[model samples]
Target: MSPVSPLLELDGAVQADGLDAGVAAHYGNPMIEQRRLLAGEAVVDLSNRGVLGVAGPDRLTWLNSISSQELRSLAPGQSAETLLLDPNGRIEYAMDVIDDGVETWLILEAGELPGLHTWLDKMRFTLRVQVVDHSLAYAVIGTMAVDPAAVHLAPAAPNGVALTWRDPWSSVGNGGFQYADAPAHPAADWHWTEALVLRDRLPALRDAVRAGTVSAAGTLALEALRIAAWRPRRATEVDEKTLPHELDWLRSAVHLNKGCYRGQETVAKVHNLGHPPRRLVLLHLDGSDAVLPVHGDEVEATKQLADGETERRGVGVITSSARHHELGPIALAVIKRTVPADITLHVQSQGISVAAAQEVIVPQSAGSVAEIPRLPRLGIRTPGH
Candidate 1:
C-alpha cells in the first residue's frame, strides 16, 4: 500500500477539464478550470485586494450623501455596491460597501487605494464618519474548503436576503452579513479586520487546490466567471470616462430618490432624460480558438455596399474580453447606436470576428437619457468659404 500523501500536497488531484487549450494560451493560466470548479465546490482566497473601514455615528448617512448608493437602506450585515463619480458623473471607482453595523467596510480594487483614500479624505468634514485603512489587519479572504456543515445553511438574520452562504469561493470580497446593532449587540464593540496575506502561505493553498483538498484558480478564470455573472469591474468596465448609468450601476449603486451629492444632478439627468452617447453591449465570438482580443481593441462594423466599396469605418470599440470555457471568447463593447446588432464586427488587432449580443442591452427607450445635443460649431467651415 502507498504511504499517505499530504492533504495539501503541491501536485495532487486537479480537474483540468474546464479550461479550453486556446483559452489557456490566451490567459496564461491552464489552471482556470480547477479554479472554476473549486468556486462551485469550496472557498477560495482573494484577500489581495484592499479593505477600508468607515465608522462613526453618522457613517451610513454620510456615505449615502456622498456616494452613488442608498447607503441608509442597507440593512445591518448587508453588502451593497457603490460608485464614486467625478463631478461630470464619470466613474472614479466602483466598490462593495458592506455594513457590519458599527463600521461599513469598503472592499476596493488594490490599485484604487491612493485615489480612493484621498477622495474620501477630501470629503470628510463636519460629518462624524471615520475612515480607517484595514488592509493589513485581517486576512480579507482565505482558502475556501467546502464545509459539509455549511451546505443547506439557512440565511442569517438581520441581513436576511443579503446574507446567503455560498461555497464562499464565489463570495470573495462579496459582503457577508454581520449581526451588528442587534438588540443584544452594540455597534461599538465591533471592529472589522482585513489581512495582508504572506506570500509564503500561498503555496499551501495552491497545494490544497491541486491535491483536491481545495481547488486552484488563476485570475483569468476568475474574470471569465465574473463576466458570466455580469458583475462589472471597476478598472475594466467602470473607469474614468464611464458614467455610472452607462455601466448599469444604477441597479446596484445609485438611488433615484436620494438627496444631493456632488454628481447627483448629472446622474439623475442621464438616468431620467438623456440618452448616453454609447450603449454597453456583449460580444460573443464565433471562433473559440481565437485569442480573446485585448482591451482597447477597435471593433469595426462593416456594412455591405452594393457598389463594392470598402467596409465603413468602425463605429464601436471593445472595452474588455476574457476566455470562458462555457462561452468561448466573450467581450463587452461600447458601440454607436447606428451599428446594428446583426452586423459582424472584427476585433481590429487580432482580426477575430464577433457578433454583439444583449446581456443587459437597453435601447433609447430603456430609461437612459439620450446624448445631450451638441451646440453647432462656432467656426463652422465650408469648402467654398
Candidate 2:
C-alpha cells in the first residue's frame, strides 16, 4: 500500500478509495470543485502518482529504442508521452516523459512504478543510463491550468529546467495517428499538466489551500475532466490485451514510423494489414437513475434473435466512469470493433441496468491505413494475361 498523502488532513478532504487511495478524492463538494478545476482555479493533489528519474547522456536514445514514441530528439523541458508494450503489441506501461537537461523524468501511476523501474533497470545493462525511483522524494501535482505558475506551485528545476510535463493529447503528434475522426476533438481544449514538486512542499501547499491562496480540487474532478477530453489513462484503460489503437492512444503515445522495438512487428502489422480487435467508445449513461457505474461493470448490447426475441449480450466493460459537470454521467468503455456505432448499450451496475448511448471514438475501420495494392495470386488468371 502507498503512503497516504498529508493533504488528507486538510479540512473537508476525503481520502479517495481503490486505485486513487491515499489521495484526496474530493473536498466535500465535488460539483463545485469540477467547475473550479475547469476554470483553472484549482490544483489537484496527485501526490500518490509515481515519479522516476533516468539520468545519463544516453537517457533519450535508450528510451527511444524501447518505447513506442520517438524520444531521441526530445529537448529539455519538452513534454512527450510513450508506451512500453509487450512483444504482442499490447500496452504494458504508459509514461509521461520530460527531459530536464540533466535527467529525464517519468511520471506514471504509483502502482506501476515498481514494475517499470525493475524492467528499466534490467534493460540498462552496459548503458550509461541510471534509473532511480524518486516517488519518495517528490510528489506530483496536477492541474488543467495552462501554466503551473497559475496555481502558485513552483515546479522543481534541478537542472535549470522546470520539471513539468505538459500532456500531448491535444493534437496528433509527429509520426502519430488519430483514429477518432472527430472534426472538433474534445482534447483540443485539454490543457492538462503535471508538475513535480518536492515532497516536503506538500505542507506549504496544504497551507496555501487553507489560506485560500490556492484552491485545491481532488482526483475525482480531474478524472471527470479527463474522461470528457477522451484521454485514456493507463491505470484504468489498459488491460492485458489492450493495444494502443484500441484506445486511440496512437494519437499521442505512439510513433508509427519509429525504429524497431519490442512490439514493432505487431504494431506495424496491425496498422498496415490488420485492424484492432476492439475499439473504444464514450458512453453517456442515463443519469436519471442517479446510479453511476463503476469501473469493470459489464456493458451489454441488445441483439434481435432469429426467433423474434431480444437478448442482452455482454459487449464490453466500462473502463472508467465519471459524472462530468456538463456531460452528466459519462464513461469510457472498450467494445468489440464490429459493434454497431448506433447501438444502445446497457451498463449493469449494482444490479440495475443503466441505458447508455454510444459515442464512437475509435471506429470499426480503425487500422490498415497503408494503401498497399494487392498482387495477383499464383496460378490465377490475370486480366492482362
Candidate 3:
C-alpha cells in the first residue's frame, strides 16, 4: 500500500545500519568499510557526492567573493575546500572546489547542489562565472602505492589540483601524500598513461557492492579519523550558527585575508578581539560500555567539590559521537570558553561520560596574519581589516 522504505529494500550497496536515516547522516560519519578500504587497498566510490562545473573567465574571481577561502590565485587543475555562507555568517554549504584552469568543478555533500546552485545564480547578476550542475560525475577514492614515476603517469596535478591537497593522517606513518582532481586523460600528443579504470571490467568488484564486496561502515571509524585529521563535518562541526573559524577551517577552507563578503564583519571582529564564543574539542570517552551521546545532547559539567547535588554547568553541546571499535568510544563536542582541561562531562540525555582528550583544532593567532593566506588578490578591499 505504501512505497517501500530504502532500508526495507536492502539491495546492493545499500547496507545502512548504524546510520542516521536523515540526509545529514552521511555528513557526519563515512562508512567503516570505506575507511577499511582506504586503509588497505581498494577503490571506494563516492557517487553520492554532487559536482558542479563553473566556468567562464570570471570563475575564480566570482568564487573568491562568495567563499571563505582564497580562490583568485588558484591555478588550473587545483582543488580546495570552500565554505558558502549566509548573510549572518552561518554556513550554507561546505564544498570541495577543483579548478581545472579553464573550468572549475565543485563537489558538495549530497542533496546540497540545487540550493547552492540557485543561490550562486542569484548572486551572479553581473559576474562572468557560469554555473552548471554535473551531479553525475563519478569520483573514486583510495590509497595507492605511490611511485615517484607516477608523476609522469598523470601530469603532476596542476597548480589548481594542488589547492585541494590535505595531508593524509593515517598514512602519516609514511610521508603522507595529498588528494587532487584531474581529468582522466592526458593530451593525446603527450603519450601518457591515463589514470582511468574501466567500470565494465570490474564485474567482481561491482558484484561486491551487490554481494557486499564493499562493506558498509559505521559512524565510529569515520569519527575517529576525522578527529585525527581535524576534518570538519556538518553536525559534528559545521552548523548553521557556527562560524568558519570555530572549526579552524582556516587550515583548509577559510581564507582569512580574503576580500569582503556577507559575514566578514563578524568574522573579523571576533577573530581580532579574542577566541570565538565556543571551541571544537576532541572527546576521548572514558565509559566505553556506556552509550555515546547523540547530537543535541547537553554537555553537563560538574564541579568536583559539589557533592551529591552537583551544580549543572552547561559548557556547550555534543555535536557527534561514535562507538569506535579501536578507540573504544569517542566523540566531537563543542565547549564554551575556558573549560578546564581535565573537566569531565556527560551527554546529558544518554548519560554517557566523555572526557576532554587532546585538542587537535588549529588555534587562531592574529587577525591580519591569519588573513594573508585566506584572502586572494582579487583587486578588491579585503574582508577583515
Candidate 4:
C-alpha cells in the first residue's frame, strides 16, 4: 500500500497512481478542470514527484561537466533542465533543475530517485558535492499558462516553502537549440511552474482547497494540456534508443555549446552530421468515438506491396495518449525517420484501427546543424587544383 497524501482526503474520489500522488486520473470532469488550469484558476499537486538536492561548493561546475546543459553559471532561482545519457548518447534520465543559492534541486519521477542518487554518489569521487534525496522534506505545486512574474505568485502554504521553478519552455534558453521548425511552436504557450515547499505544508494547502479558497485539477487535465503543447516527458516518451534530437529536446533540455560530457560526442555527431533514426510526431486521432489507444500501440501507414495489394505497414508506436477537453483524442507517437512524409497513419489498439493524422513535431530533414559542405574525395581533385 502507498502512503496516503496529505491532500488525498479532499480528493479521495480521484484515481490513484504511483508514489501515493494525490491526483485523480480525472476529477469527475477533466474538461472543466482543464479550463480552470489554462485560466490559472487551479493548481496541480505534484507531491508524488521526486526531488533531489545537490550541495557543496563544486555543485554547479560539477553538474555542468557531467550533463548536457551549461549550468556552471546557474543563478539563484533560475530554471534549467538536463539529461543523463549513456556513453552512446541514449537518454538515461531527465530532471527539471532549479537552484536556491545553497542547493540545486532536481525534480523527476520518484522511481528515478534511487538510481539517480546512487549514480551521482559514485560520480562524486573527490568532488565537493553531496547529493541528498529530499522527498521527505519538500512537495511541489503547479499552475499552467502563467508568466514568470505571475508564476512566482503561485499559491503556497505560508510554511516551510522554499522556492519556485518557472519552466523555461516558452523560448529557447542559453546554449540550447530548437529543431521544431514550425513558425509558431505550440510549446510557446506552455507556462508551467512548480513550487517546492516543506512536506508538512501540504495539509494546510489541503485545508485551503477544502475551504474553497483554492481550486485543484487532476493529472488527467495536466496530461491533456501537456500533449497539446508537444512536450516530451522522460517517463512516457523515452526508450532505449531515444536521442534528444528525435524528440527535439535540444530546444530545452540540451546545450549545444556546452562542455564535454559522457554523451557529448554522440550528441554533437548526430546533430551535426547524422539524422535521428526516429522522429516524434503528434497524432490527432479519429474522433469517431473509438477506443483510445494505449502506450506501445503500433501506428501503421498504408503501403502498397509488390503484388499490388494494399497492406498496412508499420510506421511507429504511440508513447502517450489523452482525451483533451477541446481536441477530443490526441497522442504523441514515435515513427521511423525513413517513413514517408506524406503517408497517412492509423493506430492499432486492441485490434481496433483508428485513423491518425500526423502533425510534424520532429521533421525528417532535421540535423546537420554545423552546415559543413560535403567535400570531394581526396583522389578526385578539383580542376583548379
What lDDT, from 0 to 1, does candidate 1 have? Answer: 0.55
lDDT of each: 0.55, 0.92, 0.52, 0.82
TM-score, each model? Answer: 0.70, 0.97, 0.68, 0.92
Best by TM-score: 2
The count of residue-pair clashes in candidate 2 stands at 0
Clashing pairs for predicted structure model 4, backbone only:
none
Candidate 4 weakest lDDT stretch, 10 residues: 148-157
Show model 2 residue runs off by greater than 4 Å: 1-3, 375-385
User: How would you encode candidate 1's per-residue C-alpha lDDT over 1-385 as one tens digit per residue?
Assistant: 1111122233423221222111111113434543543344433344445667787879888888878777786676555677777788888887766675677777777678777888888888878888887665422332223432131112222323232222111222222221111233211221112222333444454555555654444445555655554445676775457775564556546666767877888887876677566666677765644566767888777777889877757776777677777677778776765566555667666665554454434343434434658898779778998
Candidate 1: 10-residue stretch with minimal lDDT:
18-27
> How many backbone overlaps does candidate 1 show?
12
Local lDDT at 99 for model 1: 73
Candidate 2 residue lDDT tens string, 1-385: 3456778989999999999988999999888999999888899999998999999999999999999999999999999999999999999999999998889999999999999999999999999999999998889998888888888789999889999899999999999999998789999878898999988888888898998987889889999999999999999999999999999999999998889999989988998889999999999999897999998999999999999999999999999999898899999999999889998999999999999999989999999998988997789778999
Residue 195 lDDT in model 1? 23
Off by over 4 Å in 1: 1-39, 142-211, 303-308, 350-360, 368-385
Clashes of each: 12, 0, 15, 0
lDDT of 3 by residue, 1-385 (tens): 1111222222333333332222112322345543553343233333344567787999888888877777888766444667777777777888766676677767665557788889888988987888987644333122221321222112223223432322212221111111211122111111101121222223333444345434423334444445544456753576668876666554456656678977777766666555566666666666645666677777767765535665767877777766544565666777765666455665565454455453434332323334444566667668795
